[model samples]
Target: MSSYDFVVIGSGPAGRRAAIQAAKLKKSVLVIDDRGSVGGVSVHTGTIPSKTLRESVLNLTGWRERQFYNRRSTDNPQTNCAALNSRLSKTLLHEVDILEQQFARNNVHTLQGRATFVDKNTLRVERREADRTAVELVTAERVLVTVGTKPFRPDNIPFNNRTVLDSDAIVSDLTIPKSLTVIGAGVIGIEYATIFSALDVPVTLVEPRDSFLDFVDREVISNFTQQLLDRGMSIRLGCSAESIVLDENDWPVVTLSDGRVVRSEMLLFAAGRKGATDDLGLENLSLEADHRGRLEVNPKTMQTKVDNIYAAGDVIGFPSLASTSMEQGRIAACHAFNAPMPDAPHHFPYGIYAVPEISTIGYSEEEAKAKGLLFECGVARLRETSRGHIMGLQSGILKCLFELKTGKLLGVHVVGEGATELVHVGQAVLNLGGGIDFFMENTFNYPTLAEAYKIAALDAWNRMAHERSGKVIKLKKRKVGKKAA
Candidate 1:
């Protein structure tokens, strides 16, 4: 029997982060993972693998370089299954090694097995693979569960991993289908559909909902939708698969609710994912997971029904990016150990690694409108900047919203090259209560995408000027503090 101050289940972003945080606080920490590896699904199957495949496809096919050379050849990249996933395995191994070293440096112990609650403070570890026949029990003063989720596979969808595949299969047992029919236009489905499309494989994206990614600013979605359409991807919204069956040749023939039959060489069902909590024996703790296998917790503390236990990451649901999960894990660790937690940031950026990247932070246009905030928008296209020309870029937009009364920055939305990395500038200013004056007054480096910030600021400045009877819009003067770097 082993006892520790903290025990974290599922070595994903959340669990690993929590374990390390607890160990750093001078507490004995043990991390348990059933995957038999340090990095959870994010490294082995989820975020990293998918993003790796996207980058690999982009690089090998000269996706960014296409504008400079033979567009036809680069547009239709030739690749096989082995070459596509060759770097993926290596990347996962490297990530795992880094995580393992971190744990070692922090003196955080790790156990490999399935973890189930024997009681609120007791956990039974079934180490079947680690040792042919060993069962280990560990006791914890506090616990964190971050098992993450698995792809939702409806009974009607035949997930054979050959013709019909789930999210996991897209990374493992992957084969380039002659054509692909991706059901569910969520982040995962959209990502896979576009990845294959980049490979010149025809893709038909079907979503039951009339709108997908409703959280994103509609304008960004509009731009992204146009990019997809321009690239020859078929988007069928408000359409669901009525039936999915295999034909004589083992291809998936999908019949839609609208009475159209779409037969594709492969089908990817990435509609949604449910938390992996069913086998965790939560009944012992009187903790009931929702229908989706997600646990409800206090957003501030990450505490569940049990005072000594906490839940974070995808298991707690919504905004389930690996980045957010890590934050949630750290918050849980701080609460568990009664450590002084840092003040929460004003907003977190959302990054979608689709063909043309889309990243956003702060209130979206829709959100601002719904809140009835007095706001004005500024816009800049990437082609409007010198760097866009140097990069041979085709399309990208940066939009920023500012309150009409105050010069406070509301939101920043971007679509195209380095959108994910470009969003942090907005995040920092927004959190620091900075305003458009910062962008207008500050100088950005020449020949850079970052200059789009200054460009967008000027656009808003001009709009504000025009709206106010051609009078200059000046922010109210106040006591000034030192500026942020």
Candidate 2:
């Protein structure tokens, strides 16, 4: 029998970060995950692989140069699969190696096995070694369940790992289809659909809803939706696949609720994901997950109904980005150990690694209205930036929303090249409660896309003044750390 101060189940972003945080506080930490599954979905199937594939597609297809050169690099037969997978394989290995090193450096013990709850405080790990299996029971004062999630495969989908696939299977099994049809307009579905379209593959996106990405500002979505249309990607909304059957060529033929028949060489169902908690033995603790297999937890502390049990990551649902999950894990571990920690974040950034990329922080325009807050929207197109021209970008925008009366920065939204990286500057300003004045007054590098913030702020400044409210006060820049000259 082995015991530890903190026993983290799953070695994904959440579990790994929580275990390390506890270890730093001098607690005995053990992280349990299935054999060879250290990096979880993020590294293996979700975030890393998808982003790498996007990068590979861009490079091979000369996507970045298409605007300026108007000519693409010659297509290589190997690019269909070999070229993309080669880089992905190398990247995954390096990422896992670094994760293992972090564990070893922090003295965070990791056990390879399927972990199950023996009780609220005890866990049974069934370890498989070659032809034999070993079972071990471990006890901990606090236990964290962060097993993450798996793709939701419907019984009727008829996935064959060839003509039909799920988001998880596509990470390794995907070959550039002659024509691809993706069901679902959620982040994962849009990402894969756009990625293949970037390679000049004919991609048709089918969603049951009339609109998708409802959390994003409508203007941003309009821009993104237009981009997809311009790229020859077909979108079917307000309907669902009534039935999917294989044709004479073994291709997927999908009939929609609207009486539309769509046939594609391949179909990808990325409608949703379910929590990987079914086999976790949560019933022993009288814990139940929602219909989607998501756990209910105190958002403040990430604690489950059971006092000593906590859950984080996708298992708990919403804002399931690996970035947020890491922070949640850290917070959960600190609270479990009664360690002093920073207050919860004011907001978190959402990045969708699609063709052009979309990122947002804080309240979106729709959210602001729903909350009954008055806000002003300021927008700047990337084409106005010299950097955009240098990079041959034809479309991109940075939008800022300010509290109408006080000029307080309420949100930032962007859709374009490098939008994910660009949103951080806005995130910092929003977190500090900085307003439009900060953007107008701050000195950003010349000829950079960041200048869009200034352009946008000035636009909002004009509007705020039009309302004849909120005086712009000149403030001095304070150098906090450096010695004065």
Candidate 3:
């Protein structure tokens, strides 16, 4: 039996970060994962893989280059699936190497094994080796579980990794289908749908709900929908998949509940994510997980119901992003070691790396309205900016919500190229409680997309002035004008 100051299960973003933090605090830390490598889901299948695919599509298609070329520029700029797969795999492996080195530098032990609770303060780790029986070990004083989540697929659909794919298997493919049917319009599904569309693959996106990404601002989603349609992506909303069967050629024929059948060369199920909690032996710790096998934790401290344990990332639920997860992991470690824990960022950006991108931070328009707060809205169209027009931006918009009375900025939402990066400016303002007046008094350089922010502020100012003057005129007109007429 071996022991450590801290043990983190799953070498994903959260687990690795926590282990490193604990080690930095001069504590013996061990990170155990079932995968042979580190970097976990984020590097393997979730964020990095998806973004790499998006970049590959953009580059191969010369989508951005088309802005400067004639529409008749018929050069396809050919790229094979093998090339993409090779590049992505190489890049991911390199990243994992760097992560491994980071752990090594921090003196954090990396174990390739599966871990489960044996008691409140004990974990059983089973390691596998070639042509050998599994080796078992007991380790850890305190544990942090950051196992992440797995793609969810309906029971009716056959998840034959070759033809029918989930999020994990989708990225490992070296080929693009002629036609693909994507179930679910969540982030993962939306990303792949757009990537395939950009690659000239016909895609039919099916979502049972009328809307997707309900947490995001409605205006942003509306803009995304238009962008998807403009790119030749077909969407079927409020439609459920009744069944999926193979055609004569072994292609997928997806039947929707509305009696509509969609035939495609490939099928992708991206409904949602289920917690990676199976086989963890939570019962040993006297703990149980939810329906999705996700554990609940303290939002601030990230400690589970069991005091000596903590959980973070997707396994802990909403806003399960790599950036947030890393911070959560560090915080959990700090708290566990009784070290000084810094305050979490007052405002964090939510970035959706879809085609053209979408990002937001701070309050939503509905949230402000529901509070009955007096507000003004500022909107900037990408087409109005010289940079946007030069970039061949057909559709891009930035909107800012402000408290009318106090002139304080409430929220910012952006949809367009580099929108994810651009939203940080607004995030800084909102976090500092700065108002539209800041943009009003500042200059954002000529011909830049950032100028749109200032332009939008002016737009709102004009509307507000007009409303105020109009009200004043109405009040005077109702006073009889002292018989001047």
lDDT of the candidates, in the order given = 0.89, 0.90, 0.84
The digit string of per-residue lDDT tens for model 1 on 1-485 reads 99999999989999988998998899999999998688888988899999999998887777898889855433322355677767888888899999999999999999988999999899999887544858899999999999999988778788888888899887885677789999999999988998888887899999999988898899999998999999899999999899998999999999999999999999999999999999999999999999899999999999998999999999999989999999999999999999999977869999999888899999999999999998889898998788999999899899999988676899999999999999999999999998888887776788899999988887886678645642435644533322221
**If the candidates were sorted by their lDDT against the true structure, best first, what order would they fall in?**
2, 1, 3
Candidate 2 matches the true fold with a TM-score of 0.96
Please report the TM-score between candidate 3 and the true structure: 0.93
- For model 1, the stretches where C-alpha displacement exceeds 4 angstroms are 72-79, 129-131, 466-485
- Structure candidate 3, residue pairs in collision: none
Model 3 C-alpha lDDT per residue in residues 297-319, reported as the tens digit of each score? 99999999899899988899988
List, in order, the clash count of every candidate structure: 0, 0, 0
Ranking by TM-score: 2, 1, 3
Query: Which ranges of candidate 3 are over 4 A from the true structure?
Result: 70-78, 466-485
Indicate the worst ten consecutive residues by lDDT in candidate 3.
Answer: 475-484
Q: What overall lDDT, based on C-alpha atoms, would model 3 receive against the true structure?
A: 0.84
lDDT of 3 at 189: 86
Q: What RMSD, rounded to one decimal, does every model reach?
A: 3.6, 3.9, 5.8
